[model samples]
Target: MAHRAASGWPGVTAALAGRLAKLDLYHPRDLLLHLPLRYEDETRLTPIAAAQPGFAAQVEGEVAACEVSLRPRRQLVVRVRDASGTLVARWLHFYPAQQKLLASGRRVRLFGEVRAGFFGAEMVHPRVRAVSAEDGLPEALTPVYPTTAGVAQTTLRRLIDHALASQPLEDHLPDDLRRTLGLPAFADALRLLHHPPPDVPASVLEDRQHPAWRRIKFEELLAQQISLRRAYLARRAKTAPAMAGSGRLVRALVDALPFALTGAQRRAWAEISADLALPHPMQRLLMGDVGSGKTIVAALAMLQAVDAGWQAALMAPTEILAEQHWQKLAAWLAPLGLEVAWLSGSRAKRARAAELARLASGELRLVVGTHALIEDPVMLPRLGLAVVDEQHRFGVRQRLALREKGGAGAISPHLLMMSATPIPRTLAMSHYADLDVSVLDELPPGRSPVRTKLVSEARRDEVIARLRAACLAGRQAYWVCPLIEESETLQLQAAQKTYAALCEALPELRIGLLHGRLKAADKSATMAAFAAGELHLLVATTVIEVGVDVPNASLMVIEHAERFGLAQLHQLRGRVGRGSAESVCILLYAQPLSPAGRARLKVIYEHSDGFAIAREDLRIRGPGEFVGARQSGLPLLRYADLEADADLLEAARQVADTLLRDHPSAAAALMARWLGGREGLLRA
Candidate 1:
């Protein structure tokens, strides 16, 4: 016999179960939480003459005529008439059963939008059902649910209604708290949302301005806050090495640097230093805009760990970025008599084994590498700090794997995650509330601001001419493409084709091509050549989106710039403006831009500040995609609008603190009800 589903519902076959699983509906409780997308009003009918265009209405009428017409296309056209007026119903695609049901002389009730068509006022593909004069209308609006293929809206509504009837709906929050917040009971809210009364205004229900929506949004926000705050507390309870260095190495590195640390850098360094001194593990996020000098602060934190006789490792998302970090750190630390080891998948076998041996023996106190750092063969016996650059690119599991390499049995290493994409204030408060955040809001002195230019792809010749001129004047240029290979779906200019074209167009200049498909050695050589000014211009993909900086390269031409995100465009722009020369970043976009693409281009062109761009980006993409919430293993909000519901979020934050402190059981219950098994991912 086959096993019954966790939902304990009858008639759920293996095939039905598979289809339901696609919607994450495994248990009866899951069905209860599956809310409707929208509702259709069928409680009353309007006269055909009174129905307005561009609005949905329900009407009851007789089918005066019905026939299949092939004038413009094969379709089923029916003339529906009430006492007031006649309306045409056209179906470009129809079934035989539908035609028979909507035959002439049949009295039917239809619900759909009315519009002026060639024949007359019409509703294309209106839902029609045979009805008698005595047939009563629906008592409540019909619910339309979000579903997958093989599962119809009717199936979902039936299952949800069954779940609501069978399961007990109990309030998770305390009675006093619910009353104080001016919210209804949990059961009342769910019932009202699932089957709203006809008397309620559709606007309030659709826009989520109703009291029930408020309760649901608040509950979700409260659960998220509880999960994050509890994770924060749990991390503090863990033990870690107190890396309180004697200030010898930190002072030495700062004194030996060619440029002075800006005030923002100094403040960030101080915050990191304080965290390092604590006995508990430090989980801090260091955020800075492009060219804000976050790498140096990370370097100082690593030195503090090394000075305290502990190992430190830095993990980057890409080999290019990792190699860049290795080179810069190696150059700075080599003079101080400290060697930083490099690890990557492409490293030679003998060299990788040798480095692994050194790390295992605690002979190497500092190392920088890509995801290879998290492999089981690699070891950090005395690891005290692990810095992740472009932290958002790594998944939660990968980050945890690196932290687990501390090898200090029972003691975790300090984690310092750095992101060049500035997190908006609201986003930081909601998503990153678990960790301490330090922002580097200022750029270093003497660096020029890049001038942004929006150029249509129609002006490709002019851009190529400008690039040739810039390179001929002794300034290097970067030609960035969105893709490395041809894609049938997207007609983007590939890096290889662009490279060949540029070489042919400007025969006097030396141009190199770099992308993710290239061998590790080739990428490194190409980047080195560009840095050394051996190449006048370099064509690359987004592989150079983050690191691999060259002060001499001032002009950046991004082909198909509209395809990139706001943060990525800013980072690419940051590649320029690092030197004294006036840099220009030309964004080449194709014609016929979409509304979202147009908005993104406008934002990038108008603003140069990363924080302002980040806020706009959040507004455009919302919090989930902006922060990579799914990869970070955090549950995204389903009902709450982070921007519009900021007030409720604040209230939820305060309530989370109170519940965790005073009503621990209630907090646990709320988290269990909402997060279920997903809460464990937050420990990372």
Candidate 2:
């Protein structure tokens, strides 16, 4: 049977249908799901005498006198009075129609901010509409929705009202489940949220903690939980060859390491090894702060795969990161008589061909490259394990492509993803519920902490002198410009200008410049020089934010640090302090910082813990942009607030698990309703 169209709703016209379609509201339920952004309390009007300044107020009164004044500026002034006192309302720019509407003795309703004036209480440019005594006021708070250019607020409200009256809503939550959770029925919650009671405080509505709001939030969260749970279950049903191997290569690599793995590393590795031993492919997230030794864990996993007589491939997001991995892995693996191949878009044709041949014939036990590894030309015949480092840089499709290289008719390769940014517990539970999580919470022994300081631009010369002093002492320094933006030419010019200034400022020292605009080989060569201590000061952009590691580099100066996000700054700081030397990251911010920027800088200056910084970043940037870097496959939330509703999210996760286990049919309804368009992505 064909589904009925929302246009069929009573009083909905073709033109209105087109507008509604833009918002993806094709069903009455969609309208119901479109919750209001805020509410206007018009239940009663405040008397002009009792109105307080700096507070938004609504008033109803009769217009006693009105006139247009043109002194200093053209203005419309009207005196309105009720049983109490009178207030003066003014509009700097007014239409002739407005003047006629506020004629003498006319009754009007006004809503706007109240301000103290020379004569009395005043309202400037207030929202005014003509009214009659017979016109009734709204008995409850009026909902204000998010609307597009074509749709008017009144039209949306009426349509929603029609939906509520005509469309039948069923409670999907079980009766006992609702009682257990202390949640109201779904329909009742929507009605209460859309048209809150007159007694409901605006603070309650704004906080979104009212019982009605909680009901809606929990429902939305449960829908997401169900989708993720289903995906997790489906992946387990697929075939994946187990790569449990003898501890030959792992033991060899462990023995080669100069330092011991932290306890957290050992526990995380045990979890990963157990997962790889399972019949299902491992889709695990390896999260840790910078310098937490996630790379070592990944290396161990790859060696284990090779030990099992299958090829392993590691994919990085950038060529710089890939080259670093290749260099590090090559030194370790070559001693064990294993051929580690390197592939990247920047590789010369001859080197590429040789690696390709070795990769096809399975001569190379391990290969590390950038996205170039997933190109159609590069083939991995006996691939058993795929590791994605800095996993946030790649999308889900790209990750899936690397895993697909395991080829058809063969078991998919076990996948392990590594991230340097620590994800908060709430985000991990909801967004990464599909993947098992293993956190490397402890930094390796002998790693020094990076001390962060916020400095004003006026101290640029002092900072430069410090850099020179550090270089003279045989330590290297990194001078990072802001990350390039939409205008590549302008961004490059800025970095080039900064590099030139630094060169002039320190004529005796060797300085190098690096950015995305440089050629692939040139970038590699430049980075190699810096890593080898050939360059005393390396000036670059955010391209150096990830995967650029140097132990001897103890000083970092970030220009315009206020322009960067907390997470990005944290990543950049992570670049230093990898060695035994104590490092200092000086944040150079411009003058007149925004409140948010100042807060971010202060937070970075005080806290070095990545998990705490991540939570603060989430609170500042919100959940939408926080997880954007990682194509974690988590859908955007509409009604749930990740920060404010953390407790509710936990409850919802439990409810989702229960529903899936006990009431499959009701769970299906909930998922279908909330995740209508994204259902296919959840399916394996």
Candidate 3:
């Protein structure tokens, strides 16, 4: 029988039905399994006494005048006569109908805190509930959850209640890992995350001790490590001679460079050449900071594959990047008489067919493309080396799809994954223990260091004057807007409006605006103009956060820097500092930055090391990402941390290795129970 498809709801219909719909929401349970959007504390409630006059505070008060304000703004403002005074507590966003209940003249309980107002002490918006004034506020620790649209916080709270109540415990971790790591049982840990004890401070738990969050981080690191280990084991099991590239190719490529490759790049090339010498396929992660010459190192590696009489393939996460690689490879490798084919979903059917034919005939030595390269119709005759850029964007399934692309019974290709995320060594070693890692930590000689400054938005005129001077000096700059357009609520700059203003301010200067919502061809065209120095200034969103490179653009003025993540801000800052010219990064922010936001901005000004920034990001934001990094509904360990609990991560790694090492033994049950102890299912 055909399975019923989802009808605008996940879990309500069979997943098979989702094939016809463009829905990413799997189910509520699936969402719980998805990597956390982020982790926040539920223990933020404070006493009325500790609340500052301007801050939101939960206070006990008597009902006075519970009238709805119809004039200035639509809100339910109840005059709560507290011990201090008769305070006007406004439920700013609440519906107007709630005014009737407030006017009952009876004392009601409120959950929100008092916030300072322009006039005096007031809670601009509060959550109110009618309770006996004598009962006061609820005294239990609440679990604030990660939610989605149409999924109310209340609905999530209830679902969590049910999952905790009815789900049977299935052990997924091995006993050795469990015992050695000092980890609680999976079920117990979930309970701790969902129903933490009252003694645990929300701040502390949300900051560091929240089991759900920590466990999820640990599991993610573990999964990646496991995939890496599998690749390592597979490599070790294979025997192949590493290619010895004649100096002719390397020297020719070097001689043609715009600038000399950095010492770090030289070292990375040596490492890659050495790895190829071994009989086993090379499985290495080339980690570097943005604009750190990682692409050149990869090109050099692919050159070795050519020298070895093997075909190489480069896969990217986006078409723009794929085209970029294709152009770069054609310029460098074409001189060596190497053929490069570009494939993507956007390619004409006939063009893709021709590329596939060339690929299968072993005529096209290299093929760079997006996910289109993994389609079943595309075939590689002798694909020996595979290099994937921005490895994090691709999933295990996609990787496997590519690995299995050659005809049946073909030997697996050597894999080299590259990332510019600059994960620190200690964390990388633990998180990616299976793959050999090479770091390009050096910049080429004569490359100027980017002078970074954090300026408050109050000093706009000074910054604007500086920008005008820079432009007049014929130095191009990037003015990055965090938001694409203006909003009444936020005072941040918009790329379009800023572009218009800059054009008006300096009529002689050419300014271009680029954002995602614009046409793709237009974005590409604008970027090309910027690269060619046709535009003196490029006003853009974070869309150019990666792959769009302009070495001449030596300045980056990021507006509302406080609103972006540390990693994202670092990526933006990287857009400059690539060329030999002196560069400056001005992080402009509105006044009164939050304590955490200030600290984030400080981290950028104080340090330029991407790995250090990454560590700090992990510390500040934890292991999960903004979204879509990890698949939805993967049972994440919420109790243990791989970073904080390295000992636990190691223990888990050992247990997994030992069990897999002893497959087909009676101990399999115990190992399965340990690793899959509490997991209902894992979504790839």
Count of clashes, each model = 0, 0, 29
Inter-residue clash pairs, candidate 2 = none
Per-model TM-score versus the true fold? 0.94, 0.93, 0.66
- Best-to-worst order by lDDT is 1, 2, 3
> Residue-wise lDDT of candidate 1 within 1-684, one digit each (tens)?
122255456556778888998887777777877887888899989999999989999999999999999987899999999999999999999999999999889999999998988877899988889999999988777878889999987788888888899988888888998899999998998998889889987678889979999999999999999999999999999999999989999999999999999999999999999999999999999999999999999999999999999999999999999999999999888889999999999999999999999999999999999999998899899999999999999999999999999889999899999999999887787888898999999999989999999999999999999999999999999999864234622323466678888899999999999888789999999999999999999898888999978999999999988888898899999999999999999999998999998999999999999999999999999998998986788888888998888888899999999999999998998887777776768838
Candidate with best lDDT: 1
Off by over 4 Å in 2: 1-24, 63-79, 88-106, 117-119, 128-131, 679-684
Please give the CA lDDT of all the candidate structures.
0.91, 0.87, 0.68
Error of 3 at 382 (Å): 2.4
- Worst 10-residue lDDT window, candidate 1: 483-492
lDDT of 2 by residue, 89-131 (tens): 9999889999999999999999889999988899999989999
Candidate 3 Cα misplacement greater than 4 A, ranges: 1-248, 255-260, 277-281, 344-356, 375-377, 425-430, 484-494, 517-525, 591-596, 626-628, 631-635, 654-671, 674-684
How many residue pairs of model 1 clash at the backbone? 0
CA error at residue 670 for candidate 2, angstroms: 1.1
lDDT of 3 by residue, 1-684 (tens): 122233544233343334322323333333334223223333343434455764445565567887667868776767766555655677767665577667656666555545666545667556666657456333346656555445555555665566556546555566666566556666666666666666766565566556555554455445544544554675689655456757667677888877787888888888888887676767788989877878889888887777777778888887667777887888887877777888877777898888888889888778888888888888876777788887777875776677667552536567788888887545555545666889988765666788899998898778878887888798889998865334622323366677777778778788888765666567668878888889888888777777777778888899889988887888888888877899999999987889988989989988788888888887777655521336322333444554666754665466557555764242344323223332222212
C-alpha lDDT of residue 191 in model 1: 92
* TM-score, cand. 3 vs. native: 0.66
- For residue 258, model 1's alpha carbon misses the true position, in angstroms, by 1.8
